[model samples]
Target: MTEQAAAVVDETTVAADLVTQLEYDRYTHEDPVPDWRPAKPFAAMVGALLLQELEDASDGWLHRTLDADPELAANLGFEPDNPPSRSAISRAWSGRLAELCSTIETSARQIRQLAAERGSPIGGPYETNASEEPTGSSKRTVNRLLRRKARDLLDELQTVVLPAFELDRPDDLVYDDEELLTLEACLGVTGTAANGGAETYGDFVNPDPALDDPFYEDGPSGETPLEAIKDLSPTDIAKMVNQGAARVLTRAKPRLEFETPVMLSIDITYVAFYGEREELVRVQGAPEDKSYDWCYKFATANVVGDNVHFAAGMLPVGHADYHDSDAYPGKDKSYRVGDVVRRLVDHVNDVCRIRIRRLYADREFYATDVFSTLEQREIFYVIPARRDDRVKRFIARMNEDVDGNKQVTVKHDNAVYGPVKHGGTKSSTETTLVSLPPDEDRKEPQVFATNLDVNDEIGLDRRWAKKQINRYSRRGGIETAYSKIKEFAPWTTSTNFSIRLFHFGFAVLLYDLWLLVDFLVQTLIDVVEVRTKPRVTAPRFRAFLRREVSALL
Candidate 1:
């Protein structure tokens, strides 16, 4: 028992130190100490609250348990004769949450300082940069150029994008435009600080951004960079910030504005929660770590136009498991693929100001209600047909209708009023189904529900089925977007849903910025009509910004 207690003590060195150092008066100045009786230390109250947390016990139960169990009371810093009331513990817990957070923060800071002092490079344990020389310039010039470009990017993002999005900034927000841009860029560059990019960034920024450093020859976040960016007219400037993610999402598909007949791809991406299951709002799907199993889901909408892929809207999903609610089937089955589809589609159309030409989804999102919902919105959709009995019957009927030894190139289109319903789905009125039979050319039967009228009046012809199928294939871009996005994440094991959400939101923003940067840089290259090209790719730009952001951290 003594050996076990010692092991526990060793494991809880930081927590024990925290408890030992904390002053009683610091947490409870409002509750005055009586002169007649001496007050107990705040650690005892904290210990009591912790005991409640560990056991997840109710107030009355915890009060009884503590009084009855002498061992538990002693372990929790409570005397058997003079046990603290549950009310006193609750008040203390409520009063000192911020202080507790600060204590944790201080411990974290000390750990980071220790690592830094030990001369362990913050770029993490791995080498981030691929061995390559700077493009079209000396290493010194490239570093200097990166600093200038970063400041320019931030200035543009702040003055233009923030105003355009009409996003309200919290008054107490510590990270200003410059800082957020740096952070955002790092989020893009390192993918996430937890991913080692922040450490890499910190290494560079601390040394380079100073006046003495060769990179900041013209000082930091000042005039030279701004002056260089001024020649870009309102149209050019508009082009610059439009692609940057405004308020975590843009007002419209700026990159896809002129490029018409766009295909919007809807897909689910998962960010795995390492925390306790009860603490998270999770869903079932492949979350990288557990791709084959159920995990937290994020439904994202991506659009491809003129060779540029734009990540449009992202919605976090909530899931319902059947085992938990057999008694109440009505309550457990609210979150559906159709629900996310509607949300992301509405977001893109209404919030993003992009008129959807067609929406493409994968096989997992296959449901008659999803098709019905799209039809109701007058949105065209292409999804891999779920080979259900009803859909199989439809395909079998089409296969039988084919005449002679001729290939089954025949296309069938029908309006589904209420074909199959599930999850309390209402009736469908104008939903159209386009089905293609399996043949030697196309091995499997293809099915899609779309609002695209097949009448000859609107250039809809026999080839429309093949054309739409090819268009739906473009949804593959969202998969690549997902891969790129996951790279930018700051790895964490935090139980706070908000922290996880922020990390994801920031990563999305960074990925968008990367796409925009590549497009914009290439555009400028074309404008210059020179062999000289963009030296910094997304990864390299991130490497540069990662150093900048990490330094700030």
Candidate 2:
């Protein structure tokens, strides 16, 4: 080799000492590296990828950097004398699909075991010939598999899937461990807890050290994390994540404890963008602001029925196609909302094989398209009606029939409702508008529309429409899920939609995990006579997870 090339190779000698993430990626169905070819130090390759991530370098630039940059090569454990070729490094990344998948499964199983231990301690660690074998959770336990699904889906993104798309794995990523620890971090913040347990425990001996995090204090102090993460979001990663998460949830269906239909609550959370990247769409948040943020909106699909309250998927919103509603209800275009609901429902229904019992959305979602979609799907829904003259007339007529000094209620059985036409491209349909008398909290009477017939729907017992209207109030769980998810998310201000997407996705995953633990912990405590047992709080849970994560690094 020429002296110049030799000089370039000399700079990466540091790979000789450090260990790389390749080990975490390795699990034996027997080893694949043949002895005839000497093993190259992979740690340097790890360093190269890290540098590439932080710097968003082209492959050509990364090749040159690895050959010549001593600091970068050394940190990744490279031997400066023999750094890998660009082609060789590329091959290493592209061929790892099987290994990456294996790692995710392995990690997912570990999380399932940890969850089994909490509230339902199966036997401790199982030994080949020992007298005691680790026990599994009781067969009767509820939502156990769902808990596992949440962890598997959450961790797969950072560790297995994201790395494939980014050509690098998450630095310092933690997989589905600390079932109890996570319970403390996520549930501790929400202040929801149970008072008892199942008298079981899960324990492991000499657990592997957690993978190191290179983005935070755990990484080299000299590096800036934001600059390194630019290429992490490949074009199709978002769609993959959406499909993968649904797949995970779908797989858990056979293990479901009951046959009840699923209830989903969908809401769009508007996140403001502070960047000038031109794709930004205009979104108005809150009524008082003069100007809205150039923002990207995300739709959160959550399970809110049969007492389940975990988040499932978050779909990103694009430039919405809007048109004026018939007679101008002044509502935001309903077609976008309908389109999101239809797509999400079809996706989840295909995966989970469960019918939707009902859908609960906030008042802002009252677009003409939304109502038509719900009715067409035969999915019952309750959304605030546009408080137009027709709705007020319904309230006024109901009020006039009331006895003096007593407030009027929905006692009308054979009643008629004002019809409103709405939709775009798809033909318009009429929705029944029902007005609710105001309570102490909301002085203005609430007007809502629904397709539920009093005699036709199950559990529609109350002749007065209060019973149907009351179901919407039960949707508060999803609203609470949003607030707590934002609390659990790590702070980021990247203008890249992918980065923003990942941030939001990770937060949703964390929130779902906490809910699972919270549900198990709650059920364990809320039942029977053991209600005094201490419930883990959210703050304490956060601190517990933080300290545990730091220790892993």
Candidate 3:
């Protein structure tokens, strides 16, 4: 048995020092120490791992156990009311899995040795004898595996996924590969983030050599198919774009494992509109802090999970159709964000077939109508609290309370909403207001409004607050999703709302496929766990996708 293993088992008292030797062994190892720092104490994390080994529990059992039995957790050296979350443990384990497993193995041996010393040894050694070949051991093997996975994923995308994005065209204008040609052209521009007209395909992808098959004998001109696309209504384009996103998710869902009742995040994004086309002006809105005054607005709903992050639904905001402009004019009619949220939720439920567990939205969504909508739908939410006078007063009182300051940097109070006016009736909504410690990135202490229960006890308040905040941080992934989606979204200067919407939506479809490709590659690399970051980068995935698309031809 290793000395560090023996030391941990020999200590009878449960305190932080029980794993001192394990900490020493980590720093004194032959391999370079990891640059990552753990969120919880070193000893507390090690103790949890030991408990995990003892119980042989699943991934989320430890968190549930700790919360269910705080006294038992404290006896095991964890602070009462404050247990390390499952995600924290998983991250810590994955980051140092090789090192931690060795220590645990050594400790198991030491325990058996001590039992034998007392004249009754435990059973035979606890170890798996299975010898499976490492799939990712060599760079060549990894690339080969990745290519195979990519081919399978992309094949489905082409055959089943791309067809969902086909737009209706006049039969007289139709020809061989008309829909396929249009889809491929959009994808080509997206893959390279190219700007300008359909000629952007030739400028960026240079498809002359790649499209040399018989399908190219009577090849469509640069503006052959897409010129007709711009003639379609924005509603038609939006429907096709949404269908494409849903199709990719439906195809990937059976292959990938997703958490039950996936969490959803909705946020608004803007595309700067620079044009003098007066008729299209109705489709543009004034988004803040933009170089251009009029911009196209969009709302997107994305699945917020560790492994299965997919943008499932999208809505073109501030766009209206005037069917009867004579009586009910479209002049002063504006879109409500709360109504947008409701529609997005309905779209995911009815179209994507995803039952939402909770929603995390931007601060702009912190309105009474939004709260009413979510509460009516029975969906939990976490939104940044707007610093209105009532919330500001709470912050002031919290700052002056010295007794509360020493115990926890977090505090919570009930945020009661009106019996005033909601949804054409007098109604009320209630939620909790959480005041977190001053974030390093912000000047003011962070405050959030949530329907989730917050425990404000001595040892529990900090942990509960931190965990909630960490969960909220997952919403930031949607921003990253938008950024990566732009890499695949074709840049455009066209004032046609349909063309712009199609470009954005097609990019989202491609982005989801990229995530699925990376996910499949990850499964090939490690069947048992999911990594936070992708091994196959955006550019590499784009390369693989473009190659697969060419092969389909």
lDDT of 3 by residue, 166-250 (tens): 5566677545443444444445434532223334333333455446454343334445555656777766666766766765565
Task: Look at candidate 2 and tell me the lDDT of residue 435.
Answer: 60
List of clashing residue pairs for candidate 1: 122-199, 123-199, 123-200, 189-542, 191-488, 192-490, 201-546, 201-547, 202-550, 202-551
Relative to the true structure, candidate 1 reaches a TM of: 0.54
Candidate 2 structure quality by residue, lDDT tens digits, 255-321: 2233266777888776665655564443334333424546556788876644356566667665333
**Worst lDDT window (10 residues) for model 3?**
121-130
The lDDT, on a scale of 0 to 1, for candidate 1 is 0.50
Clashing pairs in 3: none
User: In candidate 1, what are the lDDT values of residues 278-343, reduced to their tens digit?
Assistant: 644453445445645545666677766654677766665554431122322244444566667776
Best model per TM-score:
3
Q: Which candidate do you rate higher for lDDT, 1 or 3?
A: 3
Clashes of each: 10, 27, 0
Instruction: Give the whole-model CA lDDT for all candidates, comma-separated.
Output: 0.50, 0.47, 0.61
In model 1, the runs with Cα more than 4 Å from the true position are: 1-151, 157-188, 192-204, 208-257, 273-292, 319-329, 397-426, 436-443, 455-461, 527-537, 547-553
lDDT of model 3 at residue 546?
Answer: 58
RMSD of each: 23.5, 18.7, 18.7
